[model samples]
Target: MAPSPPPPAASDAQYAQQFLNTVLSQRGPSALPYAEDVKWLIRNHLVALIDAFPSLRPRVALFNHKDGRAAHLLQADGTIPITHAGAVYNLPAVLWLPEPYPRAPPLVFLSPTPDMLIKPHHPLVDCSGLVAGAPYLRSWVFPSSNLLDLARSLSHLFGLDPPLFTRSNPPNPLPAAPSSSMLPAPSPRAPSEVVYSPRPYRFPASPQLAARPPPTEDPAEVFRRNAIAKLVDTAYAEAAALRATREAEANALFAVQAELRGRGEWVDIGVRKIAEEMEALECRLQDVTMATDVIKAWVTENHKGAADADDAEAEGAIQPADVLSRQMLDCTAADLALEDAIYALDKAVQEGSVPFDGYLRSMRALAREQFFQRVLCTKVNSAQQQAHVTRMAARAPSHYAS
Candidate 1:
């Protein structure tokens, strides 16, 4: 058998050329919507058709129009029927520069009865009689999405389960034809009008009017009264149950208390061990503290020797050891203050009134404060002496000249 030739590519070149001319004619000089939208309309529809019916995957293309618009394809020949929907949908589609673009969804009324492929679910059905004409369609906007995705969503809407992880077997009710009374009287088309008449379907009945009470006497009021009585009985039962629960809890608590008392002897041994460790730590800390004090005294002596060396170097005169001793008094006082703080901290830790870490931190802070205070006082004294010397130098020259 001879192989069939490849399906023809949909051609919208003629329609696109006509559309460009029409746009130029309409605007004369100004730009209407972007020419990109024209291309997008055809492409999006074609993709959407393929997505909705995967069988049409090989048949997607563009078909030319005598006017400016184009028909996106589904057939292997890359062609759309000249007639579709109810009328000769062969009309050129004008792009509406509103919220719903290619996504606002395509209206399917223009084609003949054959073009009514399948009634799609109304994911965003507008019941308002706003866009009524033959070619008027809803504007679909999905800022982050395209028409093919929307078509897929629409296709799935009718067939999918409600997130139940299983295929649903629910029955679909058939759409009933609307009675003439259900439709509004046909209205005349106004000048420059494009959309059609009142909606063919009547508005749904109000919830208040549609809801019918059960056959029983005042079911809601009766149910409400019965519910209250049942609630009272339930509350009483719950209270009795709660009392029984509390008695059981109290019995369990008493048993736990007895068990704890039985283990008191063992707990006493643990407490004694903790106390002995604490006492030993205290003794060790005392010995270290005494050693630290001795080292601090040696540091004071070294500071005095250094001061003497500084004085001898600066003044070219060696001061007596007694004078150097007094110069080192600041260091001595700081050392004594630090030692006292350490002793107090060691005692506090031994007493266990505060944690060992807290005691050490407190002592360190106190020693630091004392050391800074002594250094600050020495700096102030040195500055004052310098100022006095400067004042004397200024007066001495005048006094000597006089």
Candidate 2:
């Protein structure tokens, strides 16, 4: 039974559902090569084809492969309206969706009717009616590319060149479009547009033609279809170019970010080293400040400037050692002087200015004096520090009581 027509309100929804049912009605791997989701997407693409051009409807048909294996594949039978030299011609076509579709480009064949014969040496379509080398099909990018745009391209190219010619005497029909257009391909190459030459192709005795009767095409619709085809192609081309540009920009940004991150790490290492050096400098500055304070205190306590005659300590003469600190300083000075004398004596011996025996005797006498001086320095420094600490402790209680 013929399926009832959908209501006016639910027409759009029911209309889509009907085509979906037809595409899915067939069962198993024989029907479609895609999974449930892939099949749905395929159906949508077909629906889009039918929606754009109502004449085309997708249906399942058993396709015999040239390699002898047969499977069911979806085929769209329709008249693609082509504007040839200001005249619109409805060209019958059978678009075969390959099993590896979306990933693989589909095949479109010119199905001329019984009254028509394929023109020989046609640039677009060969004797077999296989349409090839259309720019859109040859450079098809999957997912973004679909049957709808392909239809647009086919229509546009067909409009430029007619693929079939009508026969004056209706002798015999041309061979029908192959049982399938999806040929098995071992390479990434698109299906060959010119597979069979006219000489070798044995036209079957039986009528096998793919020609449609003259269509009562609407002028407005024809113009609209042609315009749409041009627009879709233009938009697709622009979109592809835009995607390439955006990808390049993104890659540049990523490279810059990586370089900046490397620079940031280097800067952080420099900052840490600078901080460590600053800490070391602060420690050395504290030691220098303490030594300066000790010199200032010594000058205040005993220094008598030569110009200040009325000063309480009038003589600038060197003071005799009075405390353990003074005694320790003198002892250290003597030790350094003896070391310099020994160094001079060794140089004199090397220069042959002093006899070896004299140099040896002088070095032994200086070494004995330096050892005693260093011992006295060690004892005086220890006693001085102890006495200073005791004086500070004794004065601390008096200050606290006051």
Top-lDDT candidate index? 2
* TM-score of each model, paired residue for residue: 0.19, 0.46
Write one digit per residue (lDDT tens) for candidate 1, span 295-347: 99999989998988898898755443443344555555676777787787788
Q: Residue 174 CA error for candidate 2 (Å)?
A: 7.3
RMSD of 2: 18.4
lDDT of each: 0.41, 0.68
lDDT of 2: 0.68
Per-residue accuracy of model 2 over 1-402 as CA lDDT, tens digit each: 112233345544355557466545556543456556577778778888878876665554555566777655677766787776566677778787767887788888876667777888875677777887565776676678899998987887777556776665677645434344343222122232212111222222322223446567788987886686566657756766776688689989999999999999999999999999999999999999999999999888765664365564555455655677668768978988998898888899999999999988888889888989998988888888888888888878776757
Model 2 clash pairs are 111-210, 112-210, 112-211, 113-210, 113-211, 175-208, 176-208
Those runs of model 2 whose alpha carbons end farther than 4 Å from true positions after fitting are 1-13, 21-31, 172-402
